[model samples]
Target: MKNFKIIVLAKQVPDTRNVGKDAMKEDGTVNRAVLPAIFNPEDLNALEQALRIKDKYPGSTVTLLTMGPPRAAEIIREGLYRGADNGYLLTDRAFAGSDTLATSYALSRAIMKIGDFDFILAGRQAIDGDTAQVGPQVAEKLGVPQVTYAEEIVDIKKNKAVVRRRLEKGVETVESVFPLLITVTGTAPACRPRNAKLIMKYKRATTISERQNVSEDYIFMYDDRPFLNLPEWNVGDIEAEPERLGLSGSPTKVKKVENVVFQAKEAKVLEADNQSIEWLMKELISNHTLG
Candidate 1:
């Protein structure tokens, strides 16, 4: 069997599901500093799929790639505990205010710098953007086939990947040749928890920026163990064009944000009887609230 080189695209996004009144800033931008940052949930599913493939083939490697601020290195360290071989943190001031298009452009260029890979897996959509465009955009930028909403990767045979896709109405299976991108869906299996041994081994893994700010305790460890040094790439490192990065590259702009609060106008208390239940059903049908 051929040893596969799989790259999982993960993101450290604000936990939007627990958004509060202050989640958005006055200017309509997200208040990322106030929100709790976490590993994108669907991206965890993508990691699980990649790890499964690694288990099937000996010598296979699973590397994570995430684009965010210096703090985003947390996602890489999280992946290490979950069985990824290594990871790259793409960070720079130029990538600060990027939209989906610019984000994908930088990611595609970074992937190119990493050289050959059999698969690029990503989440179907990020909780922050929720646009579900980055993975397909990356595929288009790389000129490769893409499979979105993938629930599971069935198998790889003859350099082709069979993937099961989850749709609104039903499921569909599709196949794509090697060197393609796939975005996994939330319906896929949940990622395995961190291993105790892996945590002990990689607890001190730090990027160059992190290492510089930390105490002198791990200075000797960096020289003795190269694997403990996580890779951090800037715009210059990936050779991305300045014009196509950050706010300049982003075409989509938010106009305004409106907060809408819903309140119940009225309520009715009914006896727990068959007649009351029948009347409630009829009222709901008439109001088109149910059918």
Candidate 2:
């Protein structure tokens, strides 16, 4: 079997699901500093798919590419602990406040720099901005075919990939050739746990910016093991146009943000019986909560 070069697009996003009082700023923007950062959930699914491919094709390599703050290198290390061969962090102040379109452009440029990847895998959407546009937008910018809502990469033959996609009402299978982009969905299998050995090996992985803060004693380890240095690229490194970056390139604007709180007025207790279940379902359907 021919080994493949796969790039997994990942992200470090604010944990919006567990929002607190300090989640938003006075200017209607998210207060990411106050919120906990985590690996995007769907992106983990994408990583699992890439790792599966690498496992099936022994010589294949899984590389992770993420765009975020310098601290985002944490995700790269997380990917390394979970079977990725190497990873890159696209970090720079120039990428701040980027909308999906601008974000995709930056990622596309980075991918071009990496070069020769057979596939690009990313999450269908990010929790921070539930817009499922980045993956497809990156594909469009790179001029590659894209498959969204992918649940599984069923097989590969003759440089073609067979992918199973999840749909609202059903599932569909499609085939596409190499140099394709796929957006994995949460319905896919969860990512495997971090390997103990891999964790120990990659625990010291750090990008240049991160290394700068390290104590002098541990600095030599990074130079000794080059793999411990995760590549961190900025706008200049990727040769991106200055005007088409950050807020300058982002056209989307949020006019207002309102915090909503829901309170139950009443509650009813019922036995865990078939009749109760049927009544609950009927009530939910009647209220348009379920159908």
Candidate 3:
């Protein structure tokens, strides 16, 4: 099989499952400082898919591309530890408050800059915002075919790939040509653990912005080892239109946020008998909580 150039789109998302009181700001944006940042789960699945391709076809490269804050470069190192060849971090104030549409536009432009990739893979949705729209939107912007909810890449030929998809009701297997975009679902195989050797190899990898804050001694090492320098691109680096970035390009607006705290007014104790279960079901049906 011919080697493929694969780009995996990853994201560093706040662990929303552990959200605390400070998780959201007054402006309705996320307060990432208070929340723990994690690699998006499904994106790991996407990365695993890319790595599989690299494993099967020697000389194939898996490049990770993510758009977020400077701190988000952590995920790039995470990818490097998991077998990605290299990574690019897209960061700038212009990308702040970007909704899915703006994010897709920015990523599409970055993909164009990277050029000549055989495949683009991303998570089905980000946990922070479960819209699941960015991957397809990027494909639309790039004018390429897209396969969503991909469970596995069953096979790959010189110019095409066969993918198994996890659907709402069942699974589906389909084939698509190269230069395709795929959004991997959580149903896919979980990512392999970090390789100790790879971790040791790339532990010092830092983006340019991150390098600025480090010690002068490490700066020399970073300069000597080019791979240790992860690329950090800003809006200007991508040549994106200022008007079509960040909040200005986002059509969605958060008008309001309400916190509803439910309090238990009463409680009833019941047995596990069928009669009790039937009565509970009927009560739920009467209240429209079940039918």
Candidate 4:
């Protein structure tokens, strides 16, 4: 089997499931500090698919890519624990406050900088944005074929990948040529648990900035082992235009955000008989709730 080089795009997002009263700011933007940061759920599934490919093909490598704050380095370490070979963190204040378009543009430039990859895999969408546009946008930017909502990557051969995409009604199977991008859905297999040995080996992995802030005791250790240093790329590190990154690159802006709540005001108890059913149907039709 050809040794495949796969890149998995992951994200560190606020744990929206445990939202609190302070989850949103007065300006209608999310207050990320109040929420715990976690690996995006669907991205984990994408990592699993990449790991599976690595396991199937000897000498294959799985690398992760993520763009966020300095703390986002945690995403890379998490991927290391879950069998990824290595990862890069794209961090810089210049890349902050990016919408989906800007985010994808930065990611594409980073991808180009890394170069030479058989596949680029990512989640269908980030939980924070839920736009589901980055993966396709990256594919377009790179001029590669893309498959979204992928439940499984069935096979890869002859520079073509067979993928199974999950659909609302059923599942679809499609073939995409190499240098393609795939966005896995939550329906894909869950990521494997962290490996104890891998954790022990990579627990000390840190970026240049992170290392500077910490104790210097491990400086010699990491210097001796270059792989222990996770790559961190800033705006200047990639060939991205300044105007096409961060807020400037973003074409969309949030004018306002609203909170919506649904409540039931009334309920009617009815028998499980034909007459009750007919009456319920009539009421629904009359109210235009059913067409």
Candidate 5:
């Protein structure tokens, strides 16, 4: 089989586990610093699946792609240490607070610019937004077949692929042509640990400011280290339609983000005695809390 060019979409999101009231901005945007930064869970799973494919296909390549601030480059280097051949950091101030539509537009154009892609893989949803639109939207923009909520590969060929997809009740098998986009679900395996040698070699790979932080050891480890830095792309990187590349390109807008505070509701006690229990059951049934 010929080598395949696979692109895996990854994301870095705020660590919600550490989120506090200060973690949100006045406009409801996440204060990424207040919350720790971490890779999107499902996206890491997607990377794992792509790496598995590379292991099976000799000479195949897995290229990780992500859209976020420049600091997002950390995970790009991390992906390389974990077996990805290359990565692209889509960074631009214009892309701030982008909904899924804007994100997909930027990604689709970048993928086209990267060229020679036989398959595109993404997590079914991003932890930060939880919107699964980007995967299918990229497919639509690229005019290729897509299989979403993919769980397993049942069959593979040079010109086509067949996969099992997750559904509410059960799974369904779907087939699509090459150059297809796949949105993977958490049902897939997790990302494996990085190779020891690659970690030693590429962990120093970094973007601009990252170099400023730990320059001598990490960024200047080798005479040729600078060559590996990812080329950060802005709105100018691709021939993207202006209206489709940023806030203007997005149709959806967030109205508000309420901070939900849980409070206990008044409850009536149910006695353990059968007669009282039966009466309580009847009352609960009448109130629709029980049947």
Candidate 6:
């Protein structure tokens, strides 16, 4: 039909950028087990952008794709509950510890397997790694044009789309052809809150294995009640290129991570009085704390 198929790429990362005591191995690769995982914030923004696009184009559908451990399926289901038409997980032991370059390889391959798509949306950068490289890199792999740090989709037609993007000191509006990639920024509008109706209907949404972890009744109840169940994709279903599906296909690898500890001493209180303030100012100036 050549209609819109929006694919949003998301990631699950550590809650805080501060690595835990055992968060990283002697090698730079992340010891994910030691860190608490959470969804990437900007990716949520990208999801919202896709949803908005669907709202504008009546027949459009949104699909979310992620490359991470199996648990990342949770984010995919979460995307479905938020009104995405479908969710796909690109997971395999072979994809573990992939750097952005490698990770993009896996995601791009899975995306290609998904057939026709109108656009690829992603967060400008993961909170854990502020490099803002993956989205553009994925676009490169897909050989599609990309609009980075996008703030909004200003306009869209069957064959082209326009978007506003944030630059370091300014902004630029772009018009790119369909099947393009777009990476959004936090400055983009926040996603609409979860629709309670959708959540209640799709709350139990799970992948085949995810449902296996629980009682059959649970999944049955949701599936029977379309309002209760949502769609989720598993690894084998997407027909990804096996050699390109995991870590082996990736070129970049994490070497190690060293936590830099900056200790703070006891706090000192300073009076608000003018003379005391002057003394503190002079001391700060002398110590180069202030110019």
Cα lDDT tens digits, model 1, 80-130, are: 999999999999999988999999999999999998999999999999889
Q: With candidate 4 superimposed using the best TM-score fit, by how many Å does residue 76's alpha carbon deviate from the native?
A: 0.4
- lDDT by residue (tens digit), candidate 5, 131-234: 88889998998998899998876667868888889987999998888888999899888889888988877776776556567646544453466547776788
Clashing pairs in 3: none
Total colliding residue pairs, candidate 2:
0
lDDT of 4 by residue, 1-291 (tens): 689999999999999887888887876667878898999999999999999999999799999999999999998999999999999999999998899899999999999999899999999998887989999999999999999999999998787899999999999999989899999999999999999999999999999989987676778888788879999999999978999998899999878777654786777789999999999999999999999
lDDT tens digits, residue span 122-228, model 6: 99999887889999888998999999989999988667898999999999988999789999999999987777877775667665556668785565675465633
Model 4 alpha-carbon miss at residue 118, Å? 0.5
- RMSD, one per candidate, in order: 3.2, 4.8, 3.6, 3.7, 3.4, 4.1
| Candidate 4, superposed: residue stretches over 4 Å from native | 22-29, 261-291
How do all the candidates rank in terms of TM-score, highest first?
1, 3, 4, 2, 5, 6
Candidate 5: C-alpha lDDT: 0.83
Error of 2 at 33 (Å): 3.0
Cα deviation in Å at residue 275, candidate 6? Answer: 5.1
Query: Once superposed on the true structure, which residue ranges of model 6 sit more than 4 Å away at CA?
Result: 1-3, 17-36, 218-247, 262-291
C-alpha local distance difference test of each model? 0.94, 0.94, 0.93, 0.93, 0.83, 0.79
Residue 254 displacement in candidate 3 (angstroms): 1.0
Candidate 3 steric clashes: 0
- For TM-score, candidate 2 versus 3, the one ahead is 3
Residue 248 of model 5, lDDT score: 85
Q: What is the TM-score of each candidate against the true structure?
A: 0.90, 0.88, 0.89, 0.89, 0.85, 0.81
lDDT of 2 at 210: 87
- By summed lDDT, the worst window of 10 consecutive residues in model 4 runs over 256-265
Worst 10 residues of 1 by lDDT: 253-262
